[model samples]
Target chain A: MEIKHEKIKTNLQKILPAKASGDKWDLHLYIAGQNPKAVTAFNNLKLICEEHLKGKYHIEVIDLLKNPQIAHDDHILAVPTLVRKLPLPERNIIGDLSNKERVLAGLGLVDHSELKLV
Target chain B: MKKKERPSHRNILPKSPTSIQGLDEITGGGLPKGRPTLICGGAGCGKTLFAMEFLVRGATLYNEPGVFISFEETEKELTANVASLGFDLDNLVEHKKIWLEHIHVERGEIEQSGEYDLEGLFIRIHLAIESVGAKRVVLDTIESLFAVLPNQLILRTELRRLFQWLKRKGVTTIVTAERGEGAFTRQGLEEYVSDCVILLDHRVNDQSSIRRLRIVKYRGSTHGTNEYPFLIDEDGFSVLPVTSLGLNYSSSHERISTGIPRLDTMLSGKGYFRSSTMLVSGTAGTGKTSIASQFAEAACKRGERVLFFTFEESPSQLMRNMLSIGIDLQPWVKKGLLQFHATRPTLYGLENHLTTSIKLINKFEPNIVIVDTINGFMVGENQTEVKTMLLRLVDFLKMKQLTAFFTSLTSETENLSIPDVDISSLIDTWLLVRDLEIGGERNRGLYVLKSRGMAHSNQIREFRLTNHGIELLDVYVGSEGVLTGSARLSQETKDDAEQLLRQQEIGTKQFGLERKRDAMEAQIVVLRSEFQAEEAEALKVITIEKARNERFTQDKIKMGKSRRGDVSIKTTGTKKKKYI
Candidate 1:
C-alpha cells in the first residue's frame, strides 16, 4: 500500500504544470534573494499546487528586496515563505518547499490516506 | 392504456420485502414489488449481501421463489460465505426454491456491434425465474456489462429497455451497482433503477467496520428516510431502524433477575423483565462474558433453555474458562438446559448470520440468548447491518417474551473505537464495564449506563473474579477515585493531598474573617477608654468652677463689710429720718 501510494504521488508530480492559471487561492512565493536551490524549490511547489489543487490555486513570484516593508508587515521572518492571503482562513508555509505531502496538508486539501501522517 | 386495475394502480403499489431484519419495519414492510430496485456501493461495501439476502429471504421466508445472478463472485463462494449464517444454501438449492447463476464478463467478451443487446442476460434470468417460479430476482453487479460492452450509449439504452421488459414480466428485482469514488453508484445506476433505489455502504469508523443502508428513493410508498445501520451475520442481513414502534406493543409488568444479586437489588427489587434485551459493553477483559454467562446459568438453573452465541471464543473454550470461576455449564448442556453456538464472524455474510441465528432462535426457543463479543461480528458487516440485526434480535426476543443478553468489546485506546452496537437505545437494560487505572493499578469496574423502567446502580462497583463466581466488591469511592482494573494502596497519599488542599482553603477564609473582627474589636476598646477619661475630666472641671464661685462670693462680702462701717454712719442719719 505504501509503495503504491508513493508511486501515485511521484506520477502526479511528473505531469503537473509549473504555474496554474485562474486559481482561486493565489499564493506568492516571497524570497529575499534568488539562489539555484531556491529557484528549484519554487518551481517544484508551483508544479504540485497546480496539479492537485488545479484551478483552485495561483502562484506568484515576489522579490522581498524590492518590497522589504511588505515582507515585514506580513511577518515573513524566514527567507522563503508561501503566503495565502486571499482565502478566508489565511495560512502560511515556511520552507524550501520540498515536502509535497506537508504542503498539501498545510493547504487543507490532502487525501485522507496522506493526511494521517501530517 | 386499457382501464388499469385499482389494486394494481401505481398509487397502490405493493410493498417490497427487504427480508432482512428491521429493514421491513423502516421500509414499512419492504421495497416495492415488481420493480427494479438498485443497490449500489464501493468495493467490500456489502452490496452483494444486500442483493443476495433479498433473494434468499424472498424464497424461504416469504414463500416466493427467487433467482440470483452474480457478476463477481462464484456460486460456490457465495454459498459457502452465507453458510455460516445458517443459510443452508445447499439445502435451498436442493429444494429447487432458488436458482443461482454466475455470469463472467472478461475484457475479451466485448463485441463491437451486436443485435443481441442484453438478451443474453434476459434469457438467463428468464430461465432461472421460470425454473423455480421465482417472483423475485437479484443481478449482482449488472455494471459488469459496462466492462464487457465498450459502447456506453448501447449499454445505457439496453439497460433501460431491460428494466422495462422486467417491469412487464412483473418479477420484483434488485440490481447491484458498483459505487464510484465519491458518487452513490459507480456508473450513476441510480438513474437506471427508475422505480426504486437503495444504497449500501461499508466503512470502518473509529476502527470498527459499519454497514449503512439508505433508501435513495422509494416511489409511491411511505418509507423510512433515515440511513439505517445494519448487520451482516451468519443468519442474514438485519436493518436496525431507529424509528419507534406502534403504540399497540406488548407491555408485561413482570421483572426477572439479572443473575447478579447485588446488582439486582440495586435495580428496584430484582432486575429486568422476562424477555428484555440487556446490553453488556465494556473495554476488553472487563468480564462481559462472565456477566453474560451468569445470566445464562441462572436461567438454565431455573429449568429454562439458554442459547449462548460466541463469536470470539469456541463453546468448549468459553465453558472451560467460565468453569474456572465456578460456572458449570456442561451439566446444563447435557440436560438440554443450555446450548452453545460459537463461530468466527467471517463464517458467513451478515444476512446469512442473521438468518441462521433466527433459525437457531426459533428451534431452541431458549429462555435466554447471549451473543458474546459483538465487535467480532462487525468485521465484514457494516454499522447498519449490526444495528439492524440487534434490532431484529431485540424485537424477536420481545415478541417471544425471552430474555436476551449481548456483550460488546470496546476499544481500549479510543472512547468509541467503532460505534460498538448502540444497544443502549434498544435494550431494556444496559451494563457498562470498564478498566480503570488509579494509583498505578488497574481494577474492573461496573456501572449501569441506563435501565429502562427500573432503578439501577448508578455507582461504579469494583468487582473481582473469585473461586466461586465474580464478586462485586465494595463501592470504590475512597480518596483515590473508583479503581477499575487493579487498586493501588496509595489511597492515603491521595487522601493527604486532598486534606491539605481543603485545609489551605479553610485557613485562608478563617484568617480573613478573624482579621476583620479583631480590627473591629480594637477600635471599640479604644473608643470606650477615651470616653471614660473625658467623663472624669468634665466632673473635675465642674467641681473647680463651683469652688471658684464660692470664693468670689466670700471676697465680695468681705469688701462690702469693709466699706459698710463708713457708709453706715452717713446712711444711719438718712435711715433714721426715713424710718421716723
Candidate 2:
C-alpha cells in the first residue's frame, strides 16, 4: 500500500491554528459507524464553520472506534459526544448535532444579545 | 244552642311513656298521651324486644299494667327469652299485671271471600286489655292478619277502624309490623297508625351487627328524628345517643400525654382535650389499636377510669399482647381503674351491645372509653345503618363528657365511611395509619388527617413498638429519596453522609479559590516590577539625548561666529584694521 505520509501531513497542516489574535477555538464531531444522519450532521457543522469562521477554526472528526478509551474516560453513556478540548475556556456538548444554530450558540459562536438585555 | 254544653268532658288518655332507653330524649318526653305507635322493621331488628320492653317496663317499673299479644311466637318462648333479663314474666302473668295471649293463625286458616273483617282480632285484644286492666298494650307483628285474611281492602278498613277504637278506648298501644323492601310495612300499617310511627333496623357494619331505632313521626310530640343505635342484650335494650353528652357536663380539662413529644405538639398544647371523640382509621395492622391502647394506658396511669370494648380479641388475649409491649393493664384492672368488656358482636345484636355499654358507663362512670377496631360493627349492616349507629354512639359519648376513642378499618385509602352517621365527622380528631413502600421495604406510618379547634403536626411520623412501649422516630423529609422500613434509618445515615460530602466540597472549593487568588496576586506583582524598570530606562535615554542636543547647539553657534570673522587674528593685524 503506497501510504503517503506527505498526504497526511498536508491534511494536518490545513487543520493547524491560523492566527493567535482571534478567539482560539477547536471543536470535535463524534460519530459512530457511517449513518446518514451522522454524515449530515458532520457536513452541516463543517459548512457552517467554513462560512462563519473562514480560516480561524480547527475541527477533528473522531470515529470513537479508533479511540474507544476516550469515550470511557468521558463517561459517554450515549453515542456522538462532542467535546471542545482547547481555547482559553473548554466545553462539551452532546447529541447528533442536528441543529447547527444551536450547536454554534452552545459553543459561544453566537452573540449573547438576550443576556445583555437582562 | 249554648243551652247546655252537655256534660263538658276531656279525654283522659294514658300516655305512651316512650319506654325506649334513650329514645325519650329525641321524642320530647314520649309518644302521644294515648295513641298506637307503630313499630316496623326487617327481621332480626330487635322489633320484638322493643315491643316487649315497653310492656314489661310499663308493668314493672311504672306500675302501669300492660298486655302483650304475639301471633309469631308462643307465650312460653317469650317468657323464656326475657328470663335472662331478670324479668319475672310468670309472676306478672299470675298477678294479671301483663296478659300474654298468642293468636295462632295457620296458613291453611284462610277461606275464600270477597269481603272480610278483623272483628275477631278486635275482640281478642279488647278482652286481653280488659283482663289485665292494661294501660299499655303491644300487638306484635300485624303480618299474621294478612296471612289469614282473604281480602286486602277489608283488612285495611278494619285495621283503620281498630286503631280508631284503640284511640277511643284511650289505651296507649304499640303494634309491630313486618318490613318489606321499599315499604314501611308488608300490610301498610303506617297508614293507620299515622299518629306515632317508628322504624327499627338491624344491620352489619364492617362485619359486626348493629341495631338502630328511628322515629318516623309522632304527632304533637317532638322526637329524635335521627336513627339511634340500640343494643339488645341479656338485660333488654339500651340506646346510645352519643351527641347528647356535649359541653354542659363539666370535663376535667386535664391534658394527658400521648408519650410522644411530636404527637403531643400536634394536639392542643400537648394532648387531646378531656371528653373529646378521637377516631383512628387505618389499613390492617397499621397500629390503630396500638395508638388507642396507649391512650387507655395513659388514662389508667393518671388514676382515671377507662373502659375498653373489644369485639375481636378476648380480654385475656388483649392483656397478654399489651403486656409484651410494656403496657401492664393488669395493674389497672386490679385497681379498678380499667375495665375490659370483651364479647362477640354476634352474641346478641347492636341493641344488646349498646345496652351493655350503657350499663357499664352508667355504673362505672369511666373517664375514658375505647372501642378497638370498629370494623366488626359493619359486618351485617348496610352502609346507612352503620352510619347512624356510629353517629349516635359518638354523640352519646360526647354528651357524657367522656373521652372516647374509636378505631375503624378502611380497606383502601378511598374507602371512606359515608356521611350517614359518620363517626369521623362526629369525632374531634382523626388519625390515619397506612403502609408505604419505599427503598424496597414496606413500612407502617401514621398521620393526623384532622383535628378540630387545635393545631397538629402535618408530618408523617415513623414509629415502632419495642420493649419501651412506643418509639416514635423523626419525620420523613424525603431528602435521600423514599425510605422503607429497613432503610429509613439508613436514609438518615445517608443524610449524614451527604453533610460530610457537602463539607468536603466546600474545602476543595476553598483551596481552589485560594490558589487562584495567589496566582493572580503574584502576576500583579511581577507586572508592577517590570513597569517600574521600563520607566527608569526611558528616563535615562531622554537625559542622554538632551545632553547631545545641547552640544550640537553650541557647535552651530561657534561655526556662525567663525563665518562672520568678527575677531580674526586681532593680535597679528592690528595695523591692517579694515572692515573686511
Candidate 3:
C-alpha cells in the first residue's frame, strides 16, 4: 500500500510540473478596449514573457470595457494594468509594460542588479 | 401673431437643506441637490469637516442616507475626529444609515505599467451607495488620487466620469479638494465641476485664525457673493451670512425694562422695544458692564432667558463683581435662566466671536443677549469688519425678536464717538455713558443720543454704581452746563442757600411794613381823638360866644322892640295868651 501511494504521488507530481516547480507566473492584463496602448502593452508583455518567463507564465487578456466588473478583483485603477497572480503575494504594475527590466523586476522574475547590465 | 417669451419659473431645481445654522439662508435653501458641490480649502481649513458635517446633517436631519469615501483619513480617524462634533459615524454605519469607505493609496506601492481606468474606485463607491441606499455622498479630499496615480489625463477623465456618474445616481455629493495657489481648487478641479464650487479659507489675521467660506459659483442658483465666516464648534459648522441678512426684520411693539427705573424712564418710560438693539457706549470707568449686568438681571427677573457674553472678565469674576453690587446673577445661572459665556478677545478672530455668540444665542434661545464690551472684539480686527459683524448680529437678534444689548468702550476723549466700531447707526437705541470729570472728581453720566420711534429723555443723568446696582440721578443743569458729582452737590447747596437768604429778606421786609402800618394806624387814631377834642373845644367856645352874641343882640333888639313894641308886644302877648 505504501509503495503504491508513493508511486501515485510521484506520478501526480510529474503530471503537474507547473505547480510542482512553483515558478509559473499567471499575469492578467486589464484594458478598457482595443486601444493602441493595450495593444502595445500586450505585445511588450508577450516579448518580456518570451525572453524571461518563457513557458513558466500564462497571459490572460481581460478587456475591461467588456468585463469591467472584474477590474476591482485585482484593484485595477488605470487601464492596461499588469497583475501578477499565483504568486504568494500579488503585485500590480500600472501603464503599458514598456520597461522590460522594470517589469521583470516588478514580477520578481529578475533581480534589480541582474537587469542593471541590460 | 408675435408672442412674448415669458420668463418661465417652472424649471427650478430642488435643493437639499443641510440644517446648518445661517447656511441655508445664504444658499437660498441649501446646496444643489443631485449634483456635485466642490468644497476646496487650504490645509487645516475644515474642508473634510465641512463635508462630513453636510453628510451627517443630511442623513440625520433630512432622513437621507449617505456614503463617505475618504482618500486621506481612515474610517477610524475620521470617526474619531468628528466624534468631538457629536457625530457618531460608527453608530450611523451600524444602523446602515451611512457607509464609510477608506481608500488608502500609497504612492510607493503603485507603479505605472499600462493605461488603466479607476473602475475599482467607481465599483467601491457604487457598492457603498447601493449597500446603504444612500442619497448623499462625500468624497473627502479626492486630490489624494493625484498623489498616487501617475497619469493625470486618465485621472482627470475618470474624475469627470465619476462626477457624472454620481449625478446619474441621483445623490447629492460633496467633493473636497485642496486649495491651489491663485485657484479655487488644486489641479483646477473647478474647471470641470462647475455646478457648484465653494472655497474655504483659514487665515490668521492679527494672530487669530478665522475660517471663511464663499460660493465661487453656483449654477442656476443665487447665492451670497460675500465671504461668509463659518465656525466649527462641537455642534457643527455655523456660517454667518453677514451681507445676506436683509433689513426686513419684523418689528415688535412690546417694551422691556432696562432694570434701572430712571434709565427706563429715560427710554420713554417703557424701556426699549422688545426686539430693539441698544448700544451702550462709554469711556473707561463709565459703568458699561454694570448697565449690561443690570439689563441681564432684569431679563432674568422677568423669567426670560438671558445670555451674557463678557469678553473682558471670566464667568466667576463677573459673578463675583456683580455680587458686590447686589446683582446676584448666581441664582439666575443656577436656575438655567441666565448663561454667561466669557472669553478673552484675543482667543479668536472677530468673525469667530460673532459666530460663537450667535451660536450660543441660538442654542440658549435667550430672549435678551448682552455682549459686554463689544470693543473687546476690536483687539485683532479692523473697525469695519467689527461693525459689519455687529450689524449682522443685531439683524439676526432683531429678526428673532430678541432684545440685544451691546456695550462698547470708547476712548477717554472720544466720549460718545464709538471709535473702535461704528455700529451706532445699526443700533435702535444708543445710550452714551460718559465720565464727567469736574471739580477734581469723576462721575458717570448717561444720556440717550438716539432712540428710534420713541420719545426719549435727552437730559444727561448722573449714573451712580451703588452697592445695590446702578442708580440714575437727575444731573443739575446750572449756569456751568450740566453739573454732576461734587460740582452738582455744591451747586445745589449754593442754590438752596441763596433761596433761603432771599426768602429771609422778603420776610423781614414784610415784617417791617406790617409794623409801620400798625404805628401809622395808632397815630391816625390819636390824631382823630385830638382832632375830636379840639373840635369839641372849638364847638364849646363857638357855642358860648354865639350864645353871648345872640343874648346881647336879643337884649338890644328886645330893648328897642320894648320901646317900639310896648303897645304891639302888650297887644301880641295878650293875643298869644288868649289864643293859647
Candidate 4:
C-alpha cells in the first residue's frame, strides 16, 4: 500500500506542474489582533485546506494590527477577510467561516450540491 | 403684561450662535451648545452644504475651530463643492482652523464578520478633534454605516454610544443623515440624537423646486416651528423665516423725499418717514416704474447709494426709459451710486429671490432700496407666502434703518381694491396710482392711500410722466367731478372765458353809472342859473311897479291931502289914509 501511495504522489506532482506553476490553493486570512472571529476563521480554513488540498495548498495569515498597512493591499475593510489569490480568478469570502458549505463553495474547492451528500 | 410676567426661558439655555443668516433668530440662538444636532434631508437638499457651512462659519465668524468627518464624500469633493461658495476649505485646513477627514466605507468592500464596534471611527474623530482643538464637529451622513455593516444591533449600540461620547466630549456636534421613506431620517438616527432634529425638504411646487427647513424637535428649548424656506446659491444656505421678525424695529422720525416735489408736497410737504416701507400700487401703464425709478434717481442724486431691483425690465431698458423721462439714471449707474439688479421672477423660487435681495442689500449696503413692481414676485407664490416675505423684508429694512419702496401692479378690473399682496398694513406709506378714464381719455391719478404717522394729502393729483420727470398736477374738480388730461385744459379755458365776460359786464355797468351822474350835474347847474335870472326879473318888476304906484300915490296923496285937510276936521282923513 505504501509503494502504491508513493507512486500516486509522484504522478500527482508530475501532473500538478503541468496545470499550474504555484500551489493549487493559496489562501490569505486577514485578522486584527487576537479576535475570536479571526481565530475561528483561521482554524476553519486550515481544517478545510488540509482535508481537501492536503500538500497542494498553502495558507498565509495576516495580522492587520501588526501589519495594518498591508490591509490596504487587498482592500481589507473588515477583520477575518479570507482572500483566495491562487486561481486564475481571485475571490474573497469574509466572515467567521462557520458555514462549511458556503466557505468551500466560496473558495471554489467543492461544488455546492456535493456538500449536501457529504 | 402676561408676556413680561412669564419667566424667560431663552436666557436659561446657554446657546452657541451659529452665525448663519436667519438661522440664529429662528433657532432662538443656535443649536444647543455642546449637543448633537441631527440634520436629515434627502439628496441635494443642502444637508452637506449646511453642515459644511456651519463648520466654516463657526470657524471663521465665531473664531472656533471645527472638525468635519465625511462618510460619503471625499475631502477633495467637499473642498470643490464649497469652493464655489467662496469658502476656502483647503486654506482653512492648511491653517489648522478646520480639519477634514474622509471616512470611506464601501458596502461591498467592508464586511463585518465578528463582534466589532466603531472604535476606529471614534479614534479617528478623537485625533481630528485633538489636532484642531475643535469646538464644532460634524459627522456627515452617519447612515452610510447601515450600508457597510450587516450587524445593525452593534451599529445602533455603537451609534448611541458615539453620541454619548460626543456629548461627554463637550463639543457642539452636528450629525447629518439621509432622509428615509416615511421617516424623518434613514436608519432612525432621530432616536439617537434627541437634542435637536432639523429636517430639510426639497419639494416641487408649481414646477419650481424650493428647499424648506423645519425643526422637527428641539429638546429643552423653544424654537420656530414654522417651515422656513431656504435657498442654496453661490452664497451657501439662507433660510428665510416668514414673519419671524416681530414689530420691534426702531422707528425713525426723519423724512425722505419721494423724488417728486408735488408728490412730496402731497405727503405733508416732507415725504415718507426714513426707514419706512412705501408701497406704490397702480394698474398697468400707471407709471409705477416711473415713480420707482424717480425715487431711485432722487436717492442717487443725494449721493446716497440706491439699489433698484427690477423684475420686469432690464437694467439698460430701465436706464433708457428713465433717461427718456429726463431722470438721467445712467449717470448714477456710472458713478456707482445706483445699482440695478434685474431678474425674472421665475429665475428662482420666492425664497431664493428673498435671499438674493438680502445678499445684494448687504453687499451693496444701499441707503434706499426700490423693488419695481412687487407684484412680479407674486407669480409663483401663494398669497400668504408673499405677504409673509414682504413683511419679513420690510421688517428687516426697517430694522436696518433703510428706506424701502415696493411697487405693486394692481389689475384694472380690481381698481377699487388694493394690491394683490395686501402689503398695505406692512407699509408705512401707501401711494395708489390709478388710471382715471374720463372724457374719452385715460389719465394717471395718484393719491396717498395711507400714511401711518404723517398727515398725507387726500386730494387726487393727476400723475403725469413728463420729460422733466414725474409732475403731479391738480385735477379739475367741477360739477362733472374730477377732470384730467385735455378735459382739464378745456374746463380751465372755459372758466377763464366766463370770468372775462363777467369782468366786461361790470366795466359797462360802471361806465353807465358815471355818465348818468355827469348829466344830472349839468341839469342842476342849468336850474340854478334860471332861478337866479327869475329872481332878478322879479326884483326889477317890483321896483318899476313901486315907482308907478308912488307917482299915482303922489297924485292921490295930493288929492287925499287936500281932501284930508278938508276932512281933517270931518274925521275920515284917517280912513282915506288907511285906504291909500
Candidate 5:
C-alpha cells in the first residue's frame, strides 16, 4: 500500500490541476495516537488538500487515545481514519491517506470513480 | 502451591459460575475467570443463547455487572429473543447492571482508503464496560466483522489483540463465533480465544432433534469430556450433565412395596429396597404393566408421590387400562400423589427423553418413578444409548433415594433369563413374568428372576388378574411339572376324589369290625350258658346219687342212732381210715 501511495502521488500530481469550488470541504481525521500510519495519513492528507482545495478545505485532527469515548460518534475503528462530516452526507474513509487518489475521490475533490466501482 | 496443599477444590482457580443447570458441574466451575472463552456452533445451535446466559447469569446471580456487544443482533432484537426465555433484558439494562451495545457495520457504509484499525469497537466496548462496571463481557459472533471488513490480515491481528485486552480488563468474556467446516470456529477465532471453548450442536437422530453442549477445551482446569444434552425452555437453559452416570449415588437399606400383598410375600416378605431399580419383563399380556401400575398404586396409597411414564399408552388410556385390573390411577393423579407423563418412544431421541425426564423429576421430586415398558425407548435406539439413558436416570433417582420401577417387553419365545433391552445388569431386582403354557392351558406365572440383597421366592407363583387386584397363588408342582390353570384344577380335583375314596373305605371297615364284636359277644354268652347247664345237670345227677346214698346212710344212721356212742366212734374211725 505504501508503494502504491508513492506511485499515485507522482501520477496524480501530473494529471491533476488546482481547481477549487466555492463550497468549503470539512474533514475530520480520526486516529488513536500519533502512530506512523496516522502521521503518514496526516502528511498525505495535508499535501492533497493544499494541492487541490488549498483555501476551501478545513481539516480537524481528533486523537482517540486522549478522548477514546469520542470515537463512537463516528464509529472509528482504524488509526488514520478520515471522516468527511461537512459534505451533505457523511463519508468514512479508513486506511492511511498514502493512497492519494482514493483519498481525493473519497473527499470528493476528484471524480468519484470509487463510487462508480462500488 | 496453595492449590496443591489445600485439599479442597475452591482453592484452585477463581471462577465465574453460569447458573445454568448442571453446566457449572461440567465446567467444574463455569468458564475461566477474567479470560476470553470461545463458543462456536452452527446457525441456530444456541451459541448466542449460551453466551447471553453467561452474561446474564453473571450479572444477576453473581452480582457482577456485564456488557453484551452484539455484532449481529441489535439491542431490540436480542431483548425480544431472550424475553421469551424469561430474561428481562430491558429491566436489567435499566438497572445499570447490564449494558447492550450493537455494532452495526455494513460494508457499503465505509470505503477503504487509508490504513486503519479497530479502535472504534474497542472504545465502544470499553465505554460499555465502564458504564456498567462490568466483570463479564460477551461479544456475540464477532466474526461478523470479517464479513464486513474485507480485511482478513487486519481482523485476525486485531482479534488477537482484543482478546488480550479483555484479559487485561479482568472481565470474564465470551466471544461467540460461527462454526466452520472441520473447525471449531469460522475464521479460526478459536486460535485467539483459547482459554475455554464450548461447542453447541443441534443434531437430529431418529427424527428427534437434541441440543447438546460439550466442553471442547478448558485450559488450566478439569472438565467433563462427554457431550451433555441441554434443554431450552421457558425456565431457561439447562444441561443434563453426563457426570451423573459415574455411579456416585447412595444406596439405602429401606424397603418399599411391590403393591401386591402376595407378591410382596414372594419377595422375602418385603418388596424392593428404597431407591432400587427394578425391571418387570414379560411377553405380551403377561401383566408387566399391571405390576408396574400396582406398584404405583401402592406408592400412591402410602401417600408417596409417583411419576408414571408411559411411552406406549396415553395417560387416560393407561388409567382406564389399569382400572380394568382394579388399579385406579386416577384418584392418585387427582390427589397429586401421582403424575403421568405419556409420550411416544419415537417422539424424540434418547437424549431428549433423558433430559426431559430429568427436568420432570427435578420439578416433581417424586418418591417413586415408573417407566411402563422401557421397551418403548428401545425401538429406534441402539442398546448402548438405551443403557446409558437408563443408567443415568437410575443414578439420578438413586441419588434422590427414589424407587424406580421399569417394565420391559420380551418376545414370547425369548429366553426369560434376561430382559430384552439388556439393562438387567443395572437392575437391582428383576421380576420376570412368563406365560406358563402347559396341558394346553396358558397361565400367568410371576417369579423373581434376580433380586439383590434378599431371599426372594425361587418358585414361580401363579398370578391371576382378579377384579380386586393382582393375586398370587401358590402354584402346584407335580409330576406334570408345575401344574397351573385348568391343569392345577384337575389335579386338585383328583386329590379330592382320592381323599373321598379313602374316607369311604374307612367307614366300611368300621361297620365290619362292629358286627364281628357283636358275634363274639353272642358266642361267649352261649358258651357260658352251656357250661352253666352242664354244671346244673352234674349237680342233679350227684344230688340223685346223694339221695340214694343218703337213704342208705339214714338206715345206717338209725341203727347208729340206737347206739349214739357207736355213731360218734364210727365218725372217728372213718376219719382214721381215710388218713391211712
Candidate 6:
C-alpha cells in the first residue's frame, strides 16, 4: 500500500510534463472483491495511466463478485487482472501488478524488452 | 418423508450416482458426493470423456445441473467431441442444465505478477455453478493450470482451496489430470487431496488397444480394486465392472434342449439348464460349431432370443453350414428371434471383445448366447484374459437368466478329457466330441463329459452330421468295445446275418419233429387195429370152446343131477372158470 502511494506521488510529478497520447486507452480491471491486492493494483494502474496515458485513458473497475459473468469475456482466471481492450492487439496482465516493469512491458507501454514472462 | 428415506447408516457418506453404466458399481455407488474425484490418465485414455459423461449424466439423469470447466479443450471442440456421444452440449447449456466454460490458459499470452490467487477462476466457476445451480463440477485437466502459470506453488495452493470451496458448495466434482511418469497424475498432488482417484489406461497388448480403468483410491468406501475395461463408443463412456461381480448369480433348474434330440438325451434328457454355462470342446471338424448352432436354433425355436457370436465364420456362412446339417437359422434371423454378431476376434483385444459382447448382450437381451468357436478369442498367451472375459460374460448371462453356450476348438494332440480353454470348472454341462480313429477310420463321437445336477449319458454315441442335423447312434459296445461309423454298421449287419442263420436251423429242427409225430401216430393207429382183429378171433375161438365146455357141463350136470344135485352145479362152475 505504501509503495502504491509512493508510485502515485511520483506519477503526479510526471503528469505536468507528459502529454496525453492521441489514442484512447480502454482498460478493464477485474477483481473478485475489495482485497488489498486489488486496491493496490487499481491504484498502481491509475497512477500509470495518469502519468503515461493522462486524460485519454479510460479505466473500468469490474468486481467479479458483483458480475462474475464478465470474467468469461476476459478469460480472467486470476484476481487483480488488467485488460487493455482499446488497442487492436489486446493484452492482459494478471496478479496484483506488483512487478511494475513487467506489467508495463506486458501492456506495451514502452518498447518491448524481450523479457520472457514465463 | 425425506428423513425416513435417508439411509440407516447416516455416518456413511451419501453418494451421487454417476449413471455411467458400470462405474457406479465399481465405485461402490459413485464418487464421494460433494467432494472432488481425480481422474488421471495419459493422452487419449478417456479421462475427459469420463468427466464429461459424469457431468452429463448428473445433469440429464439425476436432475443435477453441472458445470464443466475445461482448461485443455475449447468449448467448440469439447462440444463437437461429446456430440458424437449423443450428448447435446449446446442444448443442455441453452436450457441452463449444464454450463460449459473453456478456460483458455495460453502461457505465452499470460503474465504473472506477485501475490496473486486463482480468485478469478473460482469466481468464474462459482458464477457458472450458481447460474445453473450445478450439483456437479468438472475441472477437466486442471493440471494444465500448472503449465500456464509459472508459479506452481500458488496454483497448487489455490487449487487445493478450490476443492475446499467446491466441497463447501456441496457439489460433486471431477478433476481430470494427465498421467504422470509413475504417479497417478502429472501433478501428483491431486490424488492426495481428492476424495476419490480413478486412473485410466490405454494399453496396446499384442497390437490391439484396450482402455481400462482402476480406482486408485476411494475414501470412506470400499470399492473394487481390479482394473476394469471401459469403452467409449456411440453410446458414450461406460466402465465394465465385470470383475466386480461375484458368483452369486441365481441359477435355474429349468432345462432347455440342444437342437439335437440325441444331445439332449445325452444330457439327462434335457439339453442345458437355464442360465447355465454349456461348453462344447472338440478338435477341428468335430462339429463344435454345429452343436453351438443347434443350441441357438433350439433356443430360437422356443421363441426365445438368441445371440450367436460367430467369431470364425460369417453369419451367412454359419447359417449355410448349419443348413447342411438341416438346421436352418435363417427363419430365426428373419423372425428377429436370433441375432448374429459375427466378427473376427482379432478385430479387438480381449477386453474390447468382452466390452462389445457385454454391450450386445445388454442391448439384445437374449435368452441364450452362443459364442461359436470361443477359441477365436484364444490368441497367443491370452488364455487367462479370454477366460476372465468369458467368466464375466457367463456371469452376466447367468445374472440375466440367459443360458450361455461356448464352443472351443482344441488340437487333436491335446488331452480330450478336459476343455481346451481350462474353463470346465465353470461349465454346468460339458460335452466332449472326439474323433474315433478306430478300424482305420475317423468317425465323430460325442459324449457328456459332465452334467451338473442331472443324470447324463456317459456312453459315447456315434455322432453323425446327417442331412437331418445330428444323429446319435448307439455306439457298438459289445466285445468290439466301441465301434462307430461304418464299423458299427458292418458289425450290426454281421450280427443280423448270424441271427438269421440260427433261426433257419431252428426252423428245420422243428419241421423234423412235427413229421416224426405224424408218422408215429399213423403206425400206432394201424397196430391197434391189427391187435383188435387178433383179439376178436381169439374171443370167437374161446366162444366155441365155451360152447363145447357148456355142452360138456350140461351132460355132466345131467349125470350129476342123478348123483347129487348140489355137487354137479359146482363141477360145472369150475369148468367155466377154466375156459375163462
TM-score of chain B of each: 0.56, 0.62, 0.82, 0.84, 0.83, 0.84
Per-residue lDDT for B112-173 in model 4, tens only? 33455554466667778988999999999888888876678887988999999999999999
lDDT against true structure, model 6: 0.83
DockQ for candidate 2, please give it: 0.00
Candidate 4: stretches off by over 4 Å: A1-118, B1-11, B109-112, B416-421, B501-580
Residue-level lDDT of model 1, residues A24-105, one tens digit each, is 5667666655654446557666678768766455566665555554443453433455666556455555555666665666
Which segments of candidate 3 are over 4 A away from where they belong?
A1-18, A26-55, A58-74, A95-105, A110-118, B1-10, B111-114, B419-421, B501-580
Tens digits of per-residue lDDT, candidate 6, B271-343, equal 7788888888888999988888777877887899999898998999888888999999999999999999988
Which digits, one per residue and each the tens of the lDDT, describe model 1 over residues B413-479? 7654454545567767888887777667777877787788877767777777776887876654654
lDDT (C-alpha, whole model) for all candidates: 0.72, 0.71, 0.83, 0.82, 0.83, 0.83
Model 1: CA > 4 A from native: A1-118, B1-12, B44-49, B60-63, B67-134, B206-208, B231-236, B242-249, B255-272, B277-298, B307-330, B339-364, B369-400, B404-580
Clashes of 3: 13
| Candidate 3 chain B, run of 10 with poorest lDDT | B1-10
The best candidate in terms of TM-score:
6
Q: What ordering of candidates by TM-score runs from best to worst?
A: 6, 5, 3, 4, 2, 1
lDDT of 2 by residue, B116-138 (tens): 23434565677678778988888
lDDT of 5 at B119: 74
Q: Scored by Cα lDDT, where does model 4 land? A: 0.82
For model 3, residues B122-147, the per-residue Cα lDDT tens digits are 77687788888999999988888898
C-alpha positional error of residue B53 in candidate 2 after TM-score superposition, expressed in Å = 2.4
Give the CAPRI class of candidate 5: acceptable
Candidate 2, residue B398: the lDDT equals: 69
